[model samples]
Target: MSIPAEKVRERLHALRSRMEKKHIQTVILWDPDNQYYFSGFKAISYSRPIVYWIYEQQTAYIIPELEDLHAEENAYTDSFHVYHERYNKGSNDTSFLDPFIRLLQNLPSDTRIGVEYEVMPAYVYQAVLDHGHDVVDIGEDIIDLRSVKDEEEIKWLDEAGRLSDVALDASFRHLKTGMSELEFDSYGDQAFLQAASEKYPEVVVGYENWTCSGIRRSAMPHLHSSTRTFESGDPVVHSRQVWINGYRAENERTFLFKDQATEEQKKLLKLAVDAQQAGMQAVKPGVRACDVDLAAYEVIKEAGFEDYIDHRIGHGLGLSEHEEPYLRFDNERILKEGMVYTIEPGIYVPGVGGFRHSDTVIVTADGSRSITHYPRSYEEMLIE
Candidate 1:
């Protein structure tokens, strides 16, 4: 679904207020997701270097000729400057940097510009400095702005969550021995695409899936789906991230082949489920982020499986697959209502395989509720 223009206007107004407090004159958003958050435009790829400019009075985009019409149709920017590629438009700006540098020169000498320090390219950062503009890191401010979901944003996230559950159901329904990991992922891909097309015609919907099968692959946590066939007792970790209209929901499940599953494998899977539940139960407004992680960590620790833990309990989720304000042992950020997160506490044992289940959750007025609701119990995960 298209983002409401009123939402974009409200976002810009809020950002400009932040800018005024910081005494910043302009902001350059290099990250595609950040650009989308502020301007309501996102490109398929940024290989050609699309730049978004947020000024005190107006916002603008510097894009390639190919995206001139696309940006005009989707963007909420006040103006756009087209950079050309073909030889026919030689007189126009040839490179993205050409227009970017020109625009920087137009600003006042002492203009305090804001940029995303984590993602802005060094050359781009240097260009602003060379033109006598001071740059401040506004990345955190943008993260804070996006961390809380607005009513419209939450609606899209809810839709994405429902779609993810649908995809997982399709994948698990066709699970069987001998199918390749890629083949297993294909079942859900087909189901997800068909469901999205039928339910929301013309709305932007996409997904990513990876199936790590067998003990070795599943133990590693992150890997692409391979052609290796599922064995009689192979443990499989299936991950799917679904996005609709730029908002994302992550859903994952680790299942065991019941035919030849070991007792230890079953126990490990149960621990993972218990840990995830603990993490979810800990999520509420006014709770420290670290407290949530520790709540889950303590579950595995009490079971003597603390050594198997390799990652944090969860992370903030929204426009990006993984966002800031993570739920980690070191993070002390307080949880707040309207914030969305993934509660995924994982354990990877060398011989037992990895066990984890992830579900996207939104922090409610009092506690939290998971949006992706595929069955996750040990009994439900056992695939015969």
Candidate 2:
């Protein structure tokens, strides 16, 4: 059940309405996530510099001429503007900016244009400014609209959640003691690809397991592919994902070795889990984002482990790993219906390692829904 193109158009129309309210005649989307959110086309080439322009009447795309046919075949834009160069007698011809300038000329002169300053390059900014048009920063305005998910987006997110669950289940079932951290990570990686292929053929997965054991586990956060091997009592952190129909859902869980966790270690893990639950329960429409952080902070504080809380309780999650409307102590943004975020509360002690339990959640009309369903209790930590 992929989202229909017409629904994407409707969402863009709504965005155009917002542009009109802001007195913006055009918007240039340069970020890959924003491009996918507006165009419904997922291509890794989007990681490079690209532009998606939306005018009052139509949508346009400026991409290398090499990608022209593919863009048209995918219906990436209503109109395509291509850029190419001609080779002559040992000298190259055609400036890259020529096509961009030509496209700019088609737009109305003196029109107030909006650009995503955060992602747009400095040269692009200069080129637009050189065109004698009124350019305004509209990055925040665009992000505000994107922070809240629509009905269609939530459906895709739900599908992504189900895919992640399948991946995690397979990975956990394959776990074994004495395996190197990379070995365990390979199992999870293969599991994600296998699950995504069965569920959504268009999906692509990224990120790797942050598996660590023994002394390395004591680090606050781990990264991909280390040489550490899993010992009997080593705490393990596995971060995995599933990209369903181009939508991403992430989940991280901590596992304790069988009969290996000390009483203190077990207690700390429980506190971290409880704090994560409190944060999730605090999600609701109209609540301040900071309040969600407080929910988890209060719990950890009462347990006399406030100092171990090193990061924000959670953050906004969507197409990209991190997005807007962050759930942090300093962020005063109000939570609204259709917003999706993660609630990950962690406690880290230098010699004892850390415990983190995270789940992606969506803000519903009445309250909220946890998109992730992987087991979260100590009893469920038993991999074998």
Candidate 3:
């Protein structure tokens, strides 16, 4: 197994402890990430609906027939209740829900079950209810647990951060006029894939990139890379998220082409850089999550461009692209040691375009250290 057996046991122990405290006899995990967290098995796709069930004494998984061998090899579960699809496997449970419902019906009527309220499908939830067992939410407990990164998770984050910088360096090296957004992204993808293959051999590594160039396109926060070619004087928002061993590190930079960028555009970009610095500086243990957001927001507010700000300063980053305990204005959650976050403060001006630089940071015992170290300065970002 990629994850140490002891590490998986530690995680299961932690969750089971929470379950015991809440009198939850069983926990049904619906989210793929959550399932992979407890069991070391992560399928390429979840269209078959893999479900993880955690009980006091043991753990189990409900998966399709095709994944039976994969689960046996990777999953740390004690048992697997597989549903078949092929006609030759007749008389066996034909659908995922068939085994799921059977399991629910077998549970004691008075048993209290735990489930992810937000992600569990309505029909699946109703089936649990139909079984006459009491249900409670365990999503918050899992989120709380995952917010703090373990040493092993942190190690992978560090590697992911390093790989992200490598990809960004390659992308920036190839930056020039007339390159399509998709073409720009291809340079980084190829570079990253080559590097990962050379270094890690059989390790799982992947990335996602989106390049928004020009005034109108860059103004929008999230957009897929397209065939649109870059023009001179355009503000470009290049975002890249790299993952190694399922741990992700987000690195983004907004750069301006050396062609007719207005004075206002220069100021906005600088403001964004300054705001990101403040946000990064404010990330430390024992501080409120909102404080980090406000530190960055105050920078933008002082510059009278607060209206251009739309999203929060950042969010937690780990096994998932975006995690919980986000750095938002209203979130009062205390930042803890070992927690990972992305410090991304952005401004989207209608005419000036978007300016934001994101860096993944890990909260240390005293302060935090950024993992992504790509050149984000305005001078360096100006592609000549």
Candidate 4:
């Protein structure tokens, strides 16, 4: 397991504290991240029940029978309740439900159970209700518990950030005018993976790449990479998240192909950079999360590009690129130490290209640290 045992214990301790505050006796966890968090069991959801059931005294993984041996080798928890068709060749519909019912019935009738209501499967919900166990929503609490990264998690995230910086440096070194969007993305991912293999043997990098060449196409956010070729004077909006171990760090930049950029393109890029800088400057231990967005958005407004802004400054990044406590004008969640997020303030003009740079940042007691650092100077961003 990538996470240390001490770190795992810390996570459990925090979870138990939260559970105690909410009177939650047992927790039914189905979210994969939570599964990985509680136990060192890692499994992709494939319609099979891969649950981590948390009782007052013990934690257990309920997985498919085929995965029983795998869980034994990899899972930190020794208590595993497995179910399979072969094991119950002639059993009826009760085959899958029986074990869960038995597990719940072992607890007292008044035991206050909590489930991730937003992500809990309907079958799981029915099983809890059928067993007469009191289930309450603990979705937000679970998410909040994961917002603060521990020392081990911060180590993995920092490594992920450096790997992402390696990827960005590779992409800029090889970027050219005639390459297709697919070609650029493919080459960039391969270079990142290769660099990670040589530099950090323990880390693996992967991402979903979004690339667009020319102003017309770059105006559309989340544009899928196609075979579109980059012209001589085109503006390239290239963005990707390089995931390490399961932690993600974003690396994105707006590039100009020719030696010279138009005045409007330069202005857009500077405005975006200034806005992003303002957002980065606002990150601290006690500042409101929305205030960071306002600090960035105000730059765009002052530059007369307020209407061009469509999305928030950024969102939380961890096992997933986008998560809780999103950096928008309405979210009032206060920033805290150990909370990692991105500060990407972009502007998309109607007939011009999108200009933005998204970087991974970790909030500290004083200010913040840019874990993923790449030179953002115009000289470093020119393709020619």
Candidate 5:
């Protein structure tokens, strides 16, 4: 289990406390990440709804019969309201909401319910209204609590960081001149999956962003890898993310392909590394999140590449990949200890290649600690 029953119970206790403070009689969670965070049950809900409804003193999971067995063993709460096929053929009267309503049989009609409206499905939101329950948006509270990583969560984040670096090392070993981006990507994925499978085969090895090559088309950040082969000195902006349990971490490095790189290529890559480091250094308790972003942005801006900056420094990464405490100029949220996020500063020159170095880091009491420890120096990244 990703989170032990005791840990899950502890989290539930926290939620109950928040509910008491807010006068929330019940809190219904529809977001998969939220569902996974509180309960250990992981499932995507759209048609077949998987809900976690917690009242002041009661907690139960209204899940589909298909996942009943899994939830029985994994979920922290024992009160499961499992339902079979409620939508029989085209009968709208017997929709999945019917089963959900049954789960709330004990809930009072005037009970103040809390929900994550922004991420909750429209169908589920409407069902709550139809039931005429008093609902309040508790999205901010949920986001606030999730931003801070607990000890166990930090452990998984570290594991993800270690395995991701191993995968990148294997990819570099397999890399050669004239290799196509797609071919190299396959090898990189294989390495990541291999490392993850050895410990937990069910763990997912996937990237939130594509493994962009520094070749012609690779200058475009977020572009999918094509058949373009790496030449002698191509600067490939490689970024990857892997998930263990429910936590994820990313490791990105700009590699100098089999051939030697140009002076300009080396210069830009160094700047990117420096900018990323600056951003990471700016992370610590009490500092504003935007300061971290500005720290990196200033590095690029001072280098006369302000226009090359396209996106914010980086965002928070956790259960859903991108969470709150976003590192951006407009966001003034104070950085707190135990908050883990990514700092990726890049300059994407249209004609030339792009240079980006992303790392998952955590805010500490005194400073910051990088979970992703892959080498970022020009010497380590610039391969021959």
Candidate 6:
């Protein structure tokens, strides 16, 4: 189960308490992430919108009839309102509005429905308005609720971290001087899928793995895997996504060839690693997200290479690889316990190359704990 029954019940109770306090009659959840967060089921349909309705004391699902069986089998809901229609013989029918209308008509009109306005389609919004129902936009409220993870989410994230570590280890082991960039990424991709299978057995790895080598690698933050061969003196950057129980963890690393890093390269790597450490150390309850960015920025600036430091230190990692509570220089969101994010500080020198060190970290009541365990020191990257 993505989320156990007991945990789901607890979350439902909490949500109910909040709803009652706000006097919200019902919450119409359309965001897939929110759906997966509240219920453990992953919706498999893209043809129709997946809607979850949460009342003060009852939880229901408004899904396509085609997915009713799967939702019943996998998703935990107190009630189900399935919508489907049989097509006329030899009739061309591609729209799903009729069934959707039926589902909406069933909902109470006097109820103050809360919709995820940020993610709901304009047509859906118009439909809701046309139904003469009172609606409230609670998208930010939902995001705030999800920003602080529960104990069960933390447990799953910990497992995700371990799976990512295994994939990174496999990638590092396969890293050699003459391997093509695509070959290196292929090694990590295979390793990620194999490791995820051992844990989830049903999880599918995300789209494409990133692996870039040489000077051009510095330009692209999300480098696509390429067939270019790795040179003896080149720098390589790689990243991959691992999913376990529908939760995601992304990790990246930059490797310098053995005996090939110049004095400047070594110095820049040291500064970047030190800056990353400072940023990670700054994570704590009540600290602003930008404070963490400044912690690293101060370090890089003190080292007289502030201009070279580019990009935010890190971002929140959860169902989506990049989510809320971003760690950037201008973001003012305060950090809180149970919020997990990454601290990746890099120095990209145009002609030479770039160096970056990243790690996933969870803010604790006291300080923070780094879930990722890859070595960031220069000595750890020596090819032996």
- In model 1, the worst 10-residue window by lDDT is 85-94
Roughly what TM-score does model 1 have, to 2 decimal places?
0.98
lDDT of each: 0.91, 0.77, 0.91, 0.80, 0.80, 0.77
Each prediction's number of clashing residue pairs: 0, 0, 0, 0, 0, 0
Q: How close is candidate 4 to the true structure, as a TM-score?
A: 0.91
Candidate 4 per-residue lDDT, tens place, 99-176, comes to 677788888889888899888889779978887777899888877988888777788788878877777777767677
Error of 1 at 319 (Å): 0.8
Q: In angstroms, how far off is 353's CA in candidate 5?
A: 2.2
Query: Residue 321 in model 4: shift from native, Å?
Result: 2.1
Using TM-score as the measure, name the better of candidate 1 and candidate 4: 1
- State candidate 5's TM-score: 0.91
How would you encode candidate 3's per-residue C-alpha lDDT over 1-384 as one tens digit per residue? 267788889999999999989999999999988988888788876579899999888888999999989889999999989888865775468889988888887787789999999899998899888888899999999999999999999999999999999999998889889999998888888888898889886788888989999999999999999899998889999999999888999999999986688888888888999999999999999999999999999999999999999999999999888999889999999999999999999999997899889999999999999999999887887777
Off by over 4 Å in 5: 44-47, 86-95, 103-106, 200-209, 258-263
lDDT of 2 by residue, 72-146 (tens): 656547886665555552323145466577778877887899998887889988999998999988888768878
2 against 3, candidate with superior lDDT: 3
Candidate 5 residue lDDT tens string, 1-384: 557887878888888889899999889888888988888778645577777887777678877777778888777775876666655534333334665777555577788889997977787788788778888998888898899989999988998888788877777788887888777777767887777778775654455446677545557778777787888778887778878888899888887763566777777888898898889888889999889999999998898898988888998988877898789989999988899989998888876788998999988889989888878887788777
Model 3 gets an lDDT of 0.91
Residue 162 error, candidate 2, Å? 1.1
In the range 133-167, model 6's lDDT, one tens digit per residue, is: 88888777766777888787788778777777877
Model 2 / residue 346 / CA error / Å: 1.5
